[model samples]
Target chain A: MLEFTFSVILENLLLATRWTILLSLIAFVLGGVVGLIVLFARVSHSRALRTLTIGYIELFQGTPLLMQLFLFFFGVALLGVEVSPWVAASLALTFWTSAFLAEIWRGCVEAIPKGQWEASESLAMTYTEQMRHVILPQALRIAVAPTVGFSVQVIKGTALASVIGFVELTKAGTMLNNATFRPFLVYTLVALIYFALCFPLSWYSKRLEGRLNVAR
Target chain B: MLYQMNFGDLLPYWQVLARGLLFTVVLTLVSTVAGIFVGTAGAWARTFGPKWAGTCVSIYVELIRNTPFIVQLFFIFFGLPAIGVKMGEAEAAFLAMTINLGAYSTEIIRAGIQAVPYGHLEAGSSLAMSRWEIFRHIVLKQAFMKVYPALSSQIVIVMLGSAVVSQISAEDLTYAANYIQSRNFRAFEVYLVVTGIYLALAIALRALLRGIARAVFPKG
Candidate 1:
């Protein structure tokens, strides 16, 4: 009942890339905001906040994103609230990204020399002021390259949103495979598009990492 | 209005859950064994083997690292069938996990290999150690000692990632959850319970791996 043409398949997949791109952007921007809060909580002197942030990071890092997506997708409906795959996916990925980004940023923060903290403290800067004026600026510099590097991971992660019926690139591949019965052509195109999106970012991440290594 | 939660319904699926956990453990153990071998060899080749070998390893690393694991699994399980390379679900899942872990550990292991101080290698050479002997006793051992923590984390990652293998109906932990939920119409309870199990497994697995690392490198 359906014909599988190369042009037709490519067009459909190209259209699907829009959703993938949008999901990645949504997850990344929102995750960054949440991650910064988490990072601050982690680095602060409050023991309770530190433990809470550690749990947040470990819980997200320990579980598979796929399971998180499943819980979000189904867990909401149990509360008599209806949720689309879009909302659930965004929520799950945002939290997942926060956990990872927070840990990454914390590492960069801790990597700063101890003397910087001492100097800031001696200047009578308040807790927030010390972090804001002194520590964060230097930490932000170290954070940039790794932050960019992790975006590639975020992009690859959007592919999993398809598992919850979000209809991104991987889901599009499955749909096309069903329609065309051409797994090789459809999946190869799918992998190629993913490669095109990811390789440049990975290469850039590596370059930045090299630069960071040289600086250190 | 809040709905009352019921986890009691999941109690009837203990056997299925146990089977799934066993399967996950087996898959991760096998993959870790094979994956580390692939990584060690790839690292060795990149470090000492020919230029073409290094290129092959680099390409392999980037390709696997850049793509999503689910896509890699699908390509192996679904797409490979088109090329007349048919594999059972379990076999395909195993191969995919091994390959995925291999690519990641290659980079991890390579970093370890690089961390071996040059003087140590020279010291081995001074002792009249053969190439294989130097690599086996000095380079590989020290590399493992230096990078075991990172390698253990990666292994746990691969273990958690094995959850995706259930998509191909490999009957791992997630599959057990899927089945239990379907049977009881208690998706939320089933998944939450299964998530707890996974968390426990990850903690325990990390501890176990650390124990092994301690044994392997007593000085460490």
Candidate 2:
């Protein structure tokens, strides 16, 4: 039987940490872009657009990320096009993140008092102008905390991308565990790396939430 | 190249899909019920128990909340066996899900408990109500009413999150789809079917929860 050594595992685990962070960044940025568009559609006055956006959100949020990964991974291949796992993982996370981000943002927009919208309209502002000059500023303040908070979810969610063969932290841990035959030690390190990545965000989110509450 | 989409290849796999859907529903119901009790208890401990108890609850909530469900599943399924507590994949998956949902539901229920106003408790006390009576009649009732929407949403999320258990080969909806895809090589069609079923399940679960809420808390 092969004995386990923490030092070797720690080194590889640390190296894998970078991929996790990178994946999270890509997911967050892309999700944010898609989420912004979804948010616009969700809150638009056009009933069809609003309904369509709601359907999109429900489809993404209602299913598991694991399923989404499988769909993207194999779905693309079934189309007679081979896509890299990185592309598939990114696409999957982007959609997942957008659904959540859109919801969070819609809540923030709705949190702005109705008076603000009316006030902007009274000033003869176009819909876009009203949103840009009036509603968005206030909504942005309300959104900051929750958006930051939701990022923690997105980061944790990136771990699921590993299921489709994306070589990130959890997958690295799995490989190390297979080689080391040290499930407990390997996973503990994995959990700790995750904790190190996630705790600061959690704490920061709480702090931002507290500040927002006080400001409100 | 415009590849032909052959959804017809999946026609024979209806039984597999049906079985997967059934497993998904069963897993969701089991975990949701288990989660509610665990969440309520944790909320109670944080609200009415000692300082250490609250701290412990907070730790549990934060740890579970921040980590991916996949890792938790692996920990329960693979990690526990190493410690000599061997369990089948389904049991481990259920245990993991219960723990994960319990932590989240704890926060939601705790918020509900806090939302119960102080005046109600004082009124119950002045009316010669015992602590248990006050909790049961006033605190618990009001909390449930206040947190109905949140609790309902959490249940839906838990139901969806149950798909993660397919990783451990739990034979849930995703697992079934995976099996069918491997057999038929119609990956996209299998997933499309799985997605539709999941969307329907989510809607049904939400509607069911809403009906229950109306029955339990009419004014809410």
Candidate 3:
């Protein structure tokens, strides 16, 4: 067996970390765009649209993300389209993240008193205009801290993309472990990298939450 | 060949799926109970125990919270044996789930404990209740009332997360699905059915928890 140096292992792991970061960015941006649409439907005036969005959110939220990832990986292929692991993982995480972000933003939107909505209505504003001028701007402020906090979840979530054979941080750890047989050192480094990525966002979220509460 | 969805192929594997469903439910239950026990203790330590203990608990919570559950499960199952500690796949999954949920519930329960009014503690003290007695009757009871909904939601989340244990060869619901797919080459159908079962399970678990809460805290 060939000898493996510690620095060699670290170097390989760091290279894979780039994919993890990139995948997270892709999922977050796409999920945010989709989540905004889900939010509109979730809080819309039409009862049918509201009900449809609720079911959509519940389906994603109530199931394990691993299952969702698996479904996308295989389900997409079953459609007679050639599916890459990268494409499947991105699609699955986008849906999953959007479900959560929509729910979180809904709470912020609902937190705005009914009076605000009524005031906008009395001003002869259309529904879109009311939301545009009155509700979302206010909700956006409260949404910021929690949205930032949930991004930590989004980052941690990218780790699951590895299950579909995406070559990200966690997958890289397993690959290195197979080569080096240093499960302890390898997994520890993997956890440390995740911690480094996540702790700052969590800390910032909490600080933002505290400041928001004080302002209220 | 164009893929045609064929869920009928899974009918013969009903027993396998049933066993997997049972295993997943059992795992969720065992971990939830054990996890809450650990959480209650950790919460107490964080709230009223020594400074060193509180600091240790804080570190533990942050460490567990920041990482993915899959990584935590992988570390326990694959990493610990490197140091002479060993366990069966099921046991490792159980331990990982318990520890993961414990860290979360500790934070949740501590917030509940903090929400109790200072006056309630004084009232219990005037009644000649010991500290432990006050905690059990006055503080914890009220705290539970305040945080029960949040705690219930966390339990459901953990139960859903239990799906990943299949990766380690523990025969949970997802494991059965994987096994059937490997045997019959019906990955799509098998996963679809298993995913449905999971959705039903999530709904049922939430309802069951809510029912228990109603019975235990009728006024709340």
- Best-fitting candidate, scored by TM-score: 3
Looking at candidate 2, what TM-score does chain B attain? 0.96
Q: State the TM-score of the second chain for every model.
A: 0.98, 0.96, 0.98
Best prediction by lDDT? 3
**lDDT tens per residue, model 1, A146-203:** 8988998899899989988999999999999998888988888898888888899889
Error of 2 at A143 (Å): 0.6
Compared with the true structure, what per-residue lDDT tens digits does model 3 show for residues B88-174? 999999999999999999999999999998999999999999999999998888888888888889999999999889989999999
Candidate 1 residues lying further than 4 Å off, grouped into runs, are none
After TM-score superposition, the amount by which residue B13's alpha carbon in candidate 2 deviates from its true location, in angstroms, is 2.5
Clashing pairs in 3: none
Better of 1 and 2 by lDDT: 1
lDDT of 1 by residue, B1-220 (tens): 8878898888889999999999999999999999999999999989978999999999999899988888999999999999899999999999999999999899998999999999998999999999999999999988888888899999999999999999889999999999998899999888998998999999999999988977777873
Question: How far out, in Å, is residue B191 in model 2?
Answer: 0.9
Q: B60, model 1: CA deviation in Å?
A: 0.8
Report the lDDT of model 3 for residue B166: 91
The C-alpha interface RMSD of every prediction is: 0.9, 1.4, 1.1
Q: Looking at model 1 chain A, which ten-residue stretch has the lowest summed lDDT?
A: A1-10
| Residue B55 C-alpha lDDT in model 1 | 97
A91-160 per-residue lDDT for model 3 (tens digits) = 9999999999999999999999999999899999998888888999999999999999998888888898
| Cα-based lDDT for every prediction | 0.92, 0.88, 0.93
Candidate 1: which pairs clash?
Answer: none
